[model samples]
Each structure stands twice: as C-alpha cells, then as structure tokens.
Target: MKRSYFSAPYAVWMVVFTIFPIVFVGLYAITTRRADGNDLYTGLANIGNIFGNEGTYMKVLWRSLSLALQCTAICLLLGYPCAYFLASKDFAKHKTLYVLILLPMWMNFLLRTYASMGLLERNGVINSIVTALGFKRLELIGTQGAVLYGMVYNYLPFMILPIHTVLKKMDQRVIEAAQDLGANPVRVFYKVTLPLSIPGIISGITMVFMPSVTTFAISGLLGSGNFMLIGDVIETQFMSANNWNFGSALSLFMTVLILISIGLLNRMDKSKTGNGGGKW
Candidate 1:
C-alpha cells in the first residue's frame, strides 16, 4: 500500500510546529547578549549561569517537585476508592455521579483557580460563613495549603479517569477467584486489583504530576505569588527579567528533570510487571 499525501502534511506540521521551535529554543539558550543588545553566540554560558545561580532556581525546582508529589499522593489516596466505587457499580446508576466528577473539568482552569482563591480568601464565602456562625476566619489563602488544594482540584480528574478506566476493564472473575482462594477483600485488592491497575495508576500519576509541577497560574492565583515555583521562575525570568537565555536554560533543566522522573517511573513499572509475570 502507498502512503497518502496527508501524511506529508502532518510531517511538515510536526517539523514546523514542534521540531523547529524546540531546536530554536535550545539554540537561543546557548546564545549570549551582545554589546549591541542582540543575542549572540556564547557557548554554554547560559547553562553555566543556571548552575552558578542555583539557590533560588533550585529552591523553586524543589518546591515544584514537592507540590507535585503531594498532589499525586493525595489524588491516589482519595481518588482510588472513588474510582473503584464507580467501576464496581452499575453503569446506569453511576452515570450521573461520574458526570459530576467530570463536570468540574469542563470549566476553564483559570476560572477554577480564581474561584478557589475567592473561597479561600479571608473575607470570601468560606470565611464569611464561618464568621456568621460565630467562628474565627482561618487564613487559607496565600499559603501552601491553598496551593495544594488548587493542585488537587485541578488534577483530580486526571487521576480518576485513568484509574477508573483500568478498574472498569478489570475482570470480576479474577477477583472472585481470589476470594475463592480464601483471600479477604483487602488481600484481594492488594495482591490482585492493585497490581492489575498499576498501569492506570502510573498514567494517572504522570498526568497529574507533570502539569502540576509546571503550573504557574494556580500558584500565582492561590498562593498569591508568595510561593516561588519552578514554573513561576521561568515566567519571571522570561517576562519580567527579560532573560531569555536563562529562562530557556531553566526550562530545559525542568524538562530534563521531568524526563528523568518519568524514566524512573517507567523502569519501576516494568520491574513490577516483570516480577509479577503478568499474573496480576
């Protein structure tokens, strides 16, 4: 069979939109500021600066990673049961509930973050209700808690969807077989369901963690720019400081970090699957 001309268009689009832009940014990162204020060739200087001034940037990276981890943990802890519930139930009865779970995702991300901010602020709805009930208004805005909440709220669906997909596809007979073998519910879950659903868990975790790590808008809105995340650092470097080279270098470093983490995750997943010998 011969390939169609449509494939050529897609290839051209990929080169123009993705490949060229990536190559351009990488090239830009290695360039220096000339005396005439133009970006000139200066090999490795920008990358060097990234390592040299590692204090703030490294802190931001750590903060972003920490937040991403926290979000992933919380999502898995909370979402797993919900996903299991949805998966186990009849499709007709659970349809509305599933829709409710997904409804929030349809809203704009920025709007959702701002809504969280409004509710979390001192004089916002939550605080007003608390004060009306003769209680003190807790300060939730501009704190790590708020950032964590925003992250969870935004990415919870990403965690739930993949897990639900896997759980729904699970064969009920396998679970019954475990029970027939004298395994308790918890034991069956740990030894069978959990291992079987790992691919979905991995996908969900990656989906939530990657974007959460690089989220600047949520941090700015919920944390009120008080927190310094890696994403915010990149934005500040490029937009505010007008340091393209440094910003690109930071971005490159973040990309590399994400790739490393994902690689490790994939290896662990493969090891688990290999050890299990597909029994799970």
Candidate 2:
C-alpha cells in the first residue's frame, strides 16, 4: 500500500495537465465563441467546416499522416539495426553508446532543430564542404525531404532506446535453447529474439509515430514554410487566426485519431504476444 503513494503525483499531474486540457479542448471544439468572447453551442459546426467545400484540411491531414508514416518507417529501419548492434554482447561499449544516444536529447528540442537547420541551410557546413571538394551545393532545406529528415533525426532515438532496452532485458536462456535445438543464428533470431522484441518495437513505433504526426516546429524550421502540415494548420488557427473553436476541433480530431492508432498497435502487439512473443 505504501508503494501506491508514489503514484499520487503522477495521478495529480494527469488530472491537471492531461485530463483537464483534453476536457477543456473538447468543450471548445463543440462550441463557437461570439463577438463578445462568449461561447455559444455550435454542435460540430467547426468540424463540419473541416469537411466543407474547402477540402484544404483534408490535404493537410493527409500530408501529416504521409510524412509521419515515412518517418516511422525510416526510424524503424535505422533504429532496429542500431539497437541490435548496441544490444549485442559483441559490443563491449554498448552502455557507453547508449549514453551517447541519450546525450543529445538532454538539450532543448528546439535548439537541436535549430542546429539541424544550420547544418542544412544554404552555404552551411555541408554545402561549404561540398563546394570545396568541387561538387555543386545541394538544395537541402525548404523541401519535403528536409522536413522528413528533421522528423527522423529527432525521433530516431526514441525508436532506438526502447528496442535496445527490451533487447538488453531479453532472456539469454531462450536464445541458447533455440541454438541447442540446432537453430542457426539467423533462425534463432527470427524464432526467439525477434518475437521477444515485439513489445519494444511496438513501444518505439508509438513513441516515434505519434510525435512525428503532430510536429509543427521541425517542419516549420526545416521546410522553410514550404510545407504546411495539419499541426501547422492547427497552430495557425489558434495562434494566428484566433479561431479557438476550429483549432480545438482539429486538436480533438487528431487526439481521437492518435488514440485509434494506439489501440490498433496495442491489439497487434497482443496478437503477436499470443502467437509467439514471450512476456518480458
């Protein structure tokens, strides 16, 4: 029972920050404010505008999803291998490497993105090097690729760390048992290691994908305003357009969509665990 006391702060935090904000946003989503700043019940009129003849919000939504999916996929591909290498017994400095991976995250996120922008900017370090070597400077910023790069760089560590944690905590005896059963290295990995790591993979996907989907700062900095995602649009509505009702509605929609995604991922993880993955 004493152990339960440790959770009190977390519970308070959830109520104050998460639950209250969500409820407040939901209230605003279903209502419109009048000229005198009094809220009037609108019954989804703001949501209706999302699917109205303009259809611009739909495009922004698609763009956000597409880039987020791409970022998630890229992070998975890159992080799994890095995680595997770090988790391997063959790497004597795995713990040191893990610390290095976490080091950059200690810095402010906006500052890190600003650093990336510097690296990718025209006449920046990368271009300067290429020009010195007699190669033409590449257009790195103000493009979809730059936005994707920012997402991948910032979120890749989130993917790698979870997978590494699970891999490091995995049961070595299960792997040895697979090998004793005459399984090859690759076969043992596929049959034992990979299945056990499903939980971490799912966790990594959730962490990376969710942030990538709702990011505005990274896209704004890297894309140089050329790309406008749903997050950017929502920011515009609230901060610039002063349309709290529509912004709240969009936020609510994104929240629902993200919840659905988490649900689906959870179901998939459960199914995988039932099939072959051992609980860690």
Candidate 3:
C-alpha cells in the first residue's frame, strides 16, 4: 500500500475538523455581529478588547496561567518520587502499581471530577471524618484549594506515567557505571537518572499544563463556579453571553499561547540535549 493511503485519512481529518474550525473561529474573531445580525469586519477590535487596558479578562488569563503552573509544579514534585520508586529494579510489583495508576484515568474525565465533588462537599466523606474526630467541619468545596486539588488529582497520572516510562527504559549499565565510579545513590540520581528523565519531565509538564489551563469543568464542579478561568470565560462568551466574536478571539489567543508554550518546551528539550544533560 502507498504511504498516501495512510496519510489520506489524517489529511482529511485535519482539513475537515482542525483546519475548518480554526478558519471559522478566525473569521468570527476578526468580525463583529451588528444588531442586524450581519457580521462586519472589525480588524483588531475583538483582540484588542481582550488585551486592552480596560480588558479585565486579562486577569482571568493570568489566573489560568498561574493555576496551570502551580498544578504542573505540584504534579512534578509528587510524580518524580513515585516514578523513581516504580522504576527501581527491586519493585517487583511495578506492573500491578502501573495498572492501579491507570485505573482512575480509564473513567470519563468529567465523571472522575464529579466523583471528587462528593468527597469535597460539606456533608461529604472528608468533612464527615473531620466532624467525627471532634474537629470543626472544614470548608472543602467552593474554594481555590478545591479547584487546585481537582487539577492535581486529575492530571497527576499524566505526570507519573511519562516519567515512569523514561526511568524504566533507562540504561541500568549507566547507573551501575556511576555507582562503580564512587557516586553515591543521591549523586547518581541527580547527575544521571534525573537528567536522562528530562524528556519525560518535559512531556509530563506540557501534558498537564495545557489541559489545566483550559479546564472549566473542574472549577465549575469543584469551585462551585466561583473561580472564573479563561476557559470558563470563553465558554460563557460562546454559550450564555452570545458573544461569538469575543469568544473566538479568546480561543485564538489561548491557541497561540499553547503553541508558544510547546515551542519553548521543545527548545528547552533541545538545549538539554546540547548541554549533555546526563554527563557526569
């Protein structure tokens, strides 16, 4: 079979779905719907409104970015240790552990987040335990903390799996060579294992950070709609506010931001390679 046969389907899919939607959004973003239901070309008007001095929507963008960075940092901190342990040769049950890590992710993302709501609700399991222990019932839901927890819980596996795969496939001989050279366990990990796992770390960071920025459902369910992320603002513009032009503008901005993030991360990965990240 010709390679064109395999490539044809993907090309069609991109044209119909990806390319078409972007073109549609771009048109809507650059035009304004007049009171007569006619869309007029407005040039940079919509884009300006988003980043203009009076554009308070910029705050929502910053908040989403801040939360995404925090979520990525937290996932890296928690996932690296777990990945390190799982990749250890002495961890005989690593396969079973891998399955456990993947089990929750198999469920619908919305359903998993909804289930978390039950745990964080006022009369929910966690608050019940607090009350039983004679402590005051903590306000678990409808807060920034709840939203952050949801982001971390939902995305942590993405961080772990990549790092685990990288660590597991790493050359054991390189690690042993470091040990033989009188490098302690900590030194070997810092200088060798960690550097070798940079690709996976970068993959995990991008994966978690991208979705975290655009997630509106988690904040809706967990934050009780109190937290307005850029995603939520875009959703409101398109759905409730009947402002397609502005919504499309926000969507375009975010798409550009995400693309820039991926480009920067790729550069970082290349720089790590160029600098011989794993060198002793």
lDDT of 3: 0.92
Candidate 3's TM-score reads 0.96
lDDT per residue, candidate 1, 17-109, as tens digits?
999988878987889767798878888888777666647666777889999999999999998888888888565567888899989988899
| lDDT string, candidate 3, 1-280, tens digits | 5577888999999999999999999999999999999999999899999987566798889989999999999999999999989989999999999899999989998998889999999999899999999999999899999999999999999999888888888899999999999999999989998888998898889989999999898999999999999999999999999999999999999999999999999799889865333311
| Residue lDDT tens for model 2, 1-280 | 5699899999999999999999999999999989997999999898888887578889888999999999999999999999999999989998899899999899998999999999999888888999999998999988899999999989999999889888988878999999999999999989888889999999999999999999998889999998999899999999999998999999999999999999999999989886533222
In model 3, the runs with Cα more than 4 Å from the true position are 275-280
The residue-level lDDT of candidate 3 at 101 comes to: 94
- Model 1 misses residue 12 by how many Å? 2.6
Better of 2 and 3 by TM-score: 3
Residue 109 shift from truth in candidate 2, angstroms? 1.2
TM-score of predicted structure 2: 0.94
> Against the hidden true structure, what lDDT does model 1 obtain?
0.86
lDDT of every model, 2 decimals: 0.86, 0.91, 0.92
- In candidate 1, how many Å is residue 183 off? 1.2
TM-score per prediction, in order, is 0.93, 0.94, 0.96
| Better candidate by lDDT, 1 or 3 | 3
